[model samples]
Target: MASEFELIARHFTPVVSGSRTGVCLGVGDDCALLTPRAGQRLAISVDTSVVNVHFPADAPPEAIGHRALAVSLSDLAAMGAEARWCLMALAIADADDDWLASFARGFHELCAATGTTLVGGDVTRGELAIGVTVMGEVPSGQALTRDGARPGDVLAVTGALGAGAGGLALWQRGERDMAHPLLMRYLRPQPRLEAGRGLLDLASAAIDVSDGLLADLGHVLKASGVGARMEVDSVPMAAGLVEALGPDAARRAALGGGDDYELLVSLPPDAMDEAVRRLASQGLALTPIGRVTADPGLAGVGEIGPHGWQHFHGGAS
Candidate 1:
């Protein structure tokens, strides 16, 4: 009944009222204005998803929308920044009302749940793609970084892993009814917002596991100028994952497969227990996978035969 812009202005614009700080004006204007708190610093991240690249071309519209935002939010979580606002840019090959409706519904559901607001965005007609730029805030000098890890720091991750990769494998093999919970894990990953927030002070460094745990942890090790030892046996696995894919398959997916959107953090040895307790209070589980090392290199501990997924190197297993 209304144009795309009108639909956004009417339904999405109202969500902007949730912004508590740093938003001078939101939505409807030529440009949104933001002013961060005096002692806070702004953290911004943008992510883009292309058809058949991030998700299947025929993916449910709602799943696509949820993922488009969830991936961006994961970046904020990694930085231990408070969720604030987001801007979206959409390029669509076709404009189907039903698709758009489902997408909007999923997007808004996640935004509301995470205390994030969609302030403004642009929509265009083109090849199908979605880009979301998210902004968050944290106390100055408090945002976590990949470079803060130190030798002897413990490595931990929030939530289970390998479920998404397993799910994708099942789906591609035409096993849609594969009784594994990995399907839902693949479709909708629960970003570790509360766990990340709790680690703001405790974590020496952090990153989200988008590029598989091993590869993403390698980035952190490189940035921090240190080495790490990941205990493969200690890595958390999603329920029913091992049973569905065998222990090796589950292990490979957890180590190499990406898209879990969980937080991987380095914490001082002394803070490890406290960090776990805090996250538990928030109803999250943090798994201690290993410890940082002074070797100045990356090494997988325990029975980690090989690492997780590589974008260009092709799928593992």
Candidate 2:
């Protein structure tokens, strides 16, 4: 039998298949080869998860695997790109066969579900870290960017918010039983891939809500060089989040808590109805939460709370 490192290099590294449009030489090479289609652009993103930083060291292998990929895939969704391939790098503290198997199963399952393949990566022994580099493709000029929002464009979100933050709170408080669905939502977030695809032609600007709504939207604002006015009452909240965390707490979490992985988009006012209808046709909902404004300040309409996740303000677990 081969050593653990050799086993991974031999079997796992070469597990993925090649793509006709994107890949020229996939695996078993000193360097992978890629060639983009004539009118297509390749979108690439990398996400990292450390044992204690991102998740508990003892966190379920499958959940860790799922989250590792899901977070990276979320970036693809943000760009309105179609997921194509991924490269996974693992740093394990120990060589546990069971853990590795479970993680691989979880990761591969998600890859298949999203029509993406594991193209290449490396495995090393270290302090239990995982990094996934995802590649996606979109039409050369059709890819959505944060810089496209204009004044009067409607600010919208693809799905509910606050549930993951609420679930995290419950988990930290040892009230796991109480959170129920919220807890699951925190552990296994679904990337809004279909919503992203639907918004490709509709949204003027787009981003995924990984760092809470306000912060993520701020990214769009910065990129687009515009300001926004968000309607507090229009922001969608998950069912039972307010009941569980109380109205104030729920509002804060929904606005500022990170890791929701929902799609945030800006669409022209005239296109809102058609955009919503297109998403609806794909069994997704686009909730209009606010509008782009000429004023270049972070302002909100009604009472939308403090406006999304902050890194140093204490929310990460």
Candidate 3:
């Protein structure tokens, strides 16, 4: 059996950036140190996933690693921050070297792609679980928030919705086809980092759709002290969702399904064209879903039954 120190050294230590610049000390140190860029505000968020709760116990180790970090990074994206550093805490049932190495590969691959550094973290023996604390920075006074939305602003989403939830449905049905788009969506979600940064100058308010489009949109409306009227027909849905789940069920999933991780934004009507163009230049598309209104709550979408995801809505199923 490998000791804790040996496990970390073999699997995680190599992923730490030795770049001696922004990070003073990385993994192997008692505590990681960092220096934020001058004139910028640090944005931080923590997220955790537990086996059989957030993911199936039988899920591939690589997907678990990718999902844990991707969920945390989505928060930084919602704030229009550039992801910089992340610390992970893992609890595993056993010292499975192969599983550990594969997980590290997935985590490090994302860090490399995003230019984020692995700072420091801990490992413990327990049921399978992963938690990550991510840090990013945005120009002072420029980070977008849910409160910045206002009446007459147009509501838009970075990409199609319901993919993650649809993926989960397929996975739960015992379908293990890794090549299926919905399954891939559920297993490995891509956080919208670049799209988030692009919105820093244009979006009045933004949030990532981890919970469901209508549910998460309700959050922006509540914070901004406004209401919304969605053009339900215009809501962008995941590819092949309608064909798989039928139009009504697919629409329902698109509206209330969780785990999409796509950005839902509200911006001025006059700026819509420019925002769309800017996002398009980066190979991303922004679809207009609705408009903010002076009323108090979600309108068209809310009238439909069963909105958004909640952790403990009922007794254990």
Model 2: how far is 250 from its true place, Å?
A: 1.1
Off by over 4 Å in 1: 1-12, 18-22, 175-180, 301-308, 311-317
Best by lDDT: 3
Lowest lDDT 10-residue stretch of candidate 2: 308-317
Q: Which candidate's TM-score is highest?
A: 3
Cα lDDT tens digits for candidate 2, 1-317 = 24667645543553543565356777677666776666788899999888767766655677788888998999999888999888888887666577777777778788878987776787777888889999988898999889999999999998788876877777777764533877767767787777887888888999998778888888899888999888877889877789879998898778877778889999998889998898889777789999999888677644543442474225332
lDDT ranking from best candidate downward: 3, 1, 2
- Output the lDDT of residue 92, model 1: 76
Clashes of each: 3, 3, 0
Query: What lDDT score is found at residue 290 in candidate 3?
Result: 89
Worst 10 residues of 1 by lDDT: 308-317
Residue ranges of candidate 3 with Cα displaced over 4 Å = 1-5, 15-21, 302-317
**Each prediction's Cα lDDT score?**
0.81, 0.79, 0.84
Judged by lDDT against the true structure, how good is candidate 1?
A: 0.81
Candidate 1's residue-wise lDDT over 117-197, tens digit each? 787898777788889999988889999999999999999999898877887877777666524488777877777777777
Angstrom error of the Cα, residue 190, model 2: value is: 1.6
